[model samples]
Target: MAENTKIEWCDHTFNPWMGCTKVSPGCAHCYAETRMDKRLHKVRWGKGQPRQRTGVANWKLPLKWDGEAQKATGAFDESFFNQAKLSQKRPRVFCASLADWLDHEVPTQWRVDLLNLIEQTHNLDWLLLSKRPESWSARLHEAMGGGSELARRWLNGEPPANIWVGTTVENQLLADERIPALLRIPANVRFLSCEPLLGPVNLSAIPTGEGHGLNEAFPRITMNPLRRALRDAPHVHWVITGGESGPNARPMHQDWARSLRDQCAAASVPFLFKQWGEWRPADDRDSDRPHWVGIPDGSEEDFSDSPMVRVGKKAAGRLLDAVEHNEFPQP
Candidate 1:
């Protein structure tokens, strides 16, 4: 768990466990998977042994964060949350930074326990994102309230108000496949992360703002929500876009990010441009460059950074065409 983090969207990073399989292209240069191979050598990456949970201290962090956040909001005691006496501030928690909560391999009991913790932490907004939407219906439904959906149904939404569920989409396929499934659940807030983005994702239907453009082309994905309160209000409340980081990072096309920005803007969804990954728009040059190089076009050159330069995540920054899109869903 993190008390301080560099990820702009959320506050703390809580890890229920640390491991997962490489099921999609977004998993190509997965920082978590790579770290498993290098840093946490005791645990291996892949299907059989993806990762293990940390000690209980790490597990109880959200409670501590909730209390502190409540104290800051002048909600110092059990008065807690009522119409007029609610805590002024709620700390945002990015749950499972190192593992997918939806991963079928993670014991159902772990998820049930984690859900219990989330319920106890009254003043924290938990963000539980996953790459495995395919497993959501089965795993989530199965783990409901001591293996019974009764307690979950007692609440209006399946998850409590503090929890915001999301799915990761690196390309069109995931966006298409996952969006509909995600929409089927009334998770309060639903979002999409297009990091390590791999190709043209026509998220004209389900919308998020950004992620890395892809290395190879794939069939485009098309999807929609069950409905947006009669198709008027925003369905996908938030969108985060960025490029790949690390040594083998890939470049995201400017147009790809721009297209998403436009889509989010149209849908009235909050759009956050995370970063340009290891690539940035090429600066003006005296000599002409190849069509494949210099700031990418998402085509021509997939490997070499012709016009785009390897400026790294820091230097490249999170600006899309020099504009920093730091939108978030209103809490």
Candidate 2:
């Protein structure tokens, strides 16, 4: 778990599980996959313990925090949980950056454990983002099915107050499939992560039908036709935007991010711009020489004279034309 993440959208990151199998086009540059492959190779050499193909290992366990003691003991305590609690001045924490908390491969007991941990650490808000919100929707349905007492106790009205649930919307297909599923979760604070922006996603396409099987489980958003359609669909309080990173990183054009920033502003939702990623527009690309060098690579042409499309997060990363570090919405 990274107590402080350089990824500006998330205040911190916690990984209950560290490995994942790719499930979509967005998974092509998955950071988790890269790390897992490295660890697996090491394990094979006996440098590290072997991992169960299906179960989460000790290293994959979610970091647990003890807030009650931390409140009483002050910040200097050496206890792990206390240290994490003291370190966070921000409101929300991103849970499981390397793995999906709702991944079917992770046992239900582990989910319960994670939820319980979230419940206990009430002071620190939790953001649970998943590419597989449908899996969580199914589990929530099952819990509600048997009229189980435990389920009733835990998931009666909506998700825990301290936890915000969100789903990744990489492209249109995934946005259609996963966002609706996310709308069904009982969490009070629901949001969207359109990070590693892959394509131009029009949020208006989200379904807003009534009596959709999962509608009652999660309330819909109401306002404009697009917002109203999504109203009662699932309430998205915040939006985090970013471009891809790492070698072979995809270039996210400036227009794509600006469109989202504009939409979020119109909707009155908080917008966060995370990074520029690896590539930028030809004009914005850093040059070794001064402008007086006059396009050293070739002609005496001005690079800035080209069409104004900025690539990479740094050039396009500005949110509402300014850097905005938003506080987490109330849980």
Candidate 3:
């Protein structure tokens, strides 16, 4: 992972570790897993070992920083807090795009190092996304050990102000299981990522209230399903919506994407439409070929240098509409 990435929704990507096991349907066609298996074979072999392609130990490389802000001092420094260029400024850094920072397989010490990086980079907003938000929450509490100053700081509302905790909600089942766990983590910003979206999810249908049995004297806090159910849950401020891409990319209906966009608009949340995946729309349900041929509009005209493609062909990354500018959280 690096400071520069073409992913439209974020300013940069940072992965302190590499490799992960699939935890949900969203991992069906993970681009990162494929890249790790095919391209960086040797890095998967062991720790501190040099891969065939790169002579140096891959772990020793400096965390990719886009600007010439100089190296970070100690584990936590102001340099790490510097912002990216305005043209490239999306503010939110996609933490662990290639690996799960909170994966159980990762050493606890490594997680501390990653958290240190997050704390150090205070100026740039950090977006921590995971399919295993529960594991992350558990590990975090364990690391802080019940209630230390560090734990108190996080629990007492000093959880790296730049960090936003989120979880992936691909289908209703996963949404039901994971969203609640995501809400339990204490972070400055809380939101959700429903991209590579596999099925429709209705957040309104979720149950809201205190879990089964607790002291009745607890004020009967009518636990706002959207807030209490989601730890310190605030109104969702940002949403990224996109369909799958690649040969086996699933078809996403225009209505589904539009519905979420509309919901976000109604709630005053910023919405970003990333792309239409490989399978295009066919007039008849049985038609083998896409009916509205040519790439989706708003997608880059040149496919030669684009990283995203559809069904082994260059996708213009267009939307149902004939426009090309789908970037969101607009300035």
Candidate 4:
């Protein structure tokens, strides 16, 4: 468990279990897959690959972090001028970065344990993201029926307040396929991670009828477990966008990130432009801003027509068209 993580979106990353398969184009250059093979010295690709379960000690790490988060909030409170913000400060935890909470192939007991862990860590918001949003809904329902009362709350479509459920959409096809399924899950915060973005995604169409294939994408039944138990509308609350990273990272068009940022703004949803990864916009190439310092150069100019220079994620920073859109779901 890393108390401080390089993933700009969250405070800490806790993998209750690690290891996953390549399910889509987004998995073409998975950072976790490479780490498992080279650094971690773990299993090969595909299902049934060996995953080392994070035991009780690993599960208990966040309690220590909850204490650390309060202390760290002092500096933030002073800067933001928000008094006692620490009390409202819940450290966000990116859960199962190396595994899928929605993978039906994995043992149900493993998910059960992780769900139990999420219940215990009330001070941290767990980002439970998946490539397969459909399976997640099914798997989670199974866990709810057999586990504790807290788990039953999940069955009733009232998952723990601290868990942010989300899905990954690398391109428009996936954005159409996954986002609607994601909205079906009832969580305090519903989100999307459009990293390794391969094409322009029109998130503005997600609601109503504008989005491609969204008309019959998902049944409304996902909204209510008891058919009428819920009245509050859940949607794609937060969006974390970024280009690809690593050796063969793909070039995401500047327009792709821009379109998503616009949609988030219109909807009043949180939009976090995490990074540009291997490519930074051309204008940032000569900037003296500390954030743009020491960024590398790129080769592909045809990826986008309006000048997207590959200066890596660091120099590109988290700015979308010179504006930092770091919004998160409120309550």
Candidate 5:
């Protein structure tokens, strides 16, 4: 129950349950797994392990937040433009930071209960970020009640006004695999969490078309199957990129973050640089530098020309080339 979160991007964080099997490379050093399983022993992390749901009072936290949001909404001016402004003013809830809401192993009833809670919290924007975007449609449809109109809208890629869906893309392969699946189901604001970025990712890679490649020419006679197959694709509304944190965290290439930020700027998509994580460029100015953690000699040697120094998360900070990117997509 992180009612007041320090996640940089969200107002609060709510995890319905605790426990998750590692699905991708990004989960290698999960802070949640470290804190919950190894330290707190709240729930074991792996397949076949049962997810432990939070207490009844924990479940009611969002209801309280929603009521507060409703009160704020009531104070806004009633003009049509102000309605949009009010939506933007709504507090964001980053749901299931400790577990995947669409995790196949979680009980179906748990997901249904979460959905019911979301329905009641229309005043708050629920960001349902998942590593498993492929399962989102089926899971959401079932949770919404299969034959209902709400279910139909979700299946049709138009989810509720307050729900924003997103997926994690650590590199090009995942960006290719997950971004397309995410774009297929348009949400109020679709986003990509490129946190713990493993390698350089070209967000505008032709076939993936994260938020670019719209002007590419199509074959007039349909001889080129690939070109003809391409259709106008939906754009990613926001991009959140950052390096890794925690023990054994991998250092992200500075260019990897820069590439994403440049791509987002070109596409007019909002971009948020969360943090530099546990590593920072060795050449950073003395004014911004923190107490340097001593690393073994030659440990800094890497394939890249520019080396990174382990500075701890607090010292590493969230500045990207000295600029703080705190942009968020319009609701």
Candidate 6:
């Protein structure tokens, strides 16, 4: 429906369909599943569940947005283009927050239609994030094989300018697993969403050393003299890292977020810290307020030694090292 979203990274959220199965640890407390399945009962969420496509009216919303964008930029003088890039002026649409666009179980025709819709929306930037990046090429090939010029460009490894592909990477393990898959696909802007970040991640180096046959499987992800993962030029254009929110939200270590910010800075890539989630540092002034301690009363680790506090999502807010990082990659 092209609804305005509270998500900090995107201007709007559009789902061609509803419903998705849990694929990783990040899906343990998925807000979409909770809202769509548990409360609204719109669709069941699981491996065998049926995916429900949204109404035709919802599908046409992007066309209206693209029309608005065209009107905004159509008459702009050359001076405006010289000052700011066209992508910075356009609104970004998070393609599918409620479902994965690359889900294997979703009807092929639905994905094909969505791709067509994306192709038609010339002025709108579509952010397509998926958990199953490994299936992107196959699913995209199937969708594009249906007489789409955009498909030809994509098959040729030249993705459309408006399409920004990313994958959800919650930890180092997932970072290694999914990122290589995403890097294989050629895209205008490639990114990583480390939301609900469970553990520390080194973007520049692969800790496993094994790389799961990375030398042969993914030649693009190579280790240089500095032991930098990926290429020397930083193939990942942007990085968005944040903690978990909602009930049972896990606490993210302060150093975890800091390390990512530092890595992005060194690589000269755009880094965006979305939120601190429901947990904040225990040493903050807000800790004086009544809140649940991050650790249990009697656990192997002492609660007093815990470095985080459950101050609720609103009060916790989105600040890393006392700085609000709201950076975006230029499309």
Instruction: State which candidate has the highest TM-score.
Output: 6
Off by over 4 Å in 5: 75-82, 85-87, 145-152, 206-233, 284-303
Task: Write the number of the candidate with greater lDDT, choosing between 1 and 6.
Answer: 6
Off by over 4 Å in 6: 75-86, 207-221, 224-234, 284-306
TM-score of each: 0.82, 0.70, 0.71, 0.79, 0.84, 0.86
For all candidates, what are the clash counts? 17, 10, 6, 2, 0, 1
lDDT of 1 by residue, 269-289 (tens): 788999988877676752353
Q: For each candidate, what is the lDDT? A: 0.69, 0.58, 0.56, 0.69, 0.76, 0.78
lDDT by residue (tens digit), candidate 4, 1-331: 3446878888789887777777888888888878876677775656877666766887778777765764665433333422232223667888877777777667777888878877765556788889998776578667876575566787676667667888888887787778777766667667789887777787545532224356666643322211111344556667889888888766777877888887666666668888888766666344552322232122222443555555666765777767877776664
Give the worst 10-residue stretch by lDDT in candidate 1: 207-216
TM-score of model 3 vs. true structure: 0.71
- Model 6 agreement with the true structure over 44-125: per-residue lDDT tens digits: 9999999999999999899888889879878444454334332677788998989998899898788878888988887778
Q: What pairs collide in candidate 4? A: 277-313, 279-310
Worst lDDT run of 10 residues, candidate 4, spans: 221-230
RMSDs, each prediction? 6.7, 8.6, 8.3, 7.3, 6.1, 4.3
Using lDDT, rank the candidates from best to worst: 6, 5, 1, 4, 2, 3
- Residue range 31-58, candidate 2, lDDT tens digits: 7666565545421211133322333443
Candidate 6 clashes between residue pairs 3 or more apart in a chain or in different chains: 204-229
lDDT of candidate 3 at residue 303, scale 0 to 100:
26
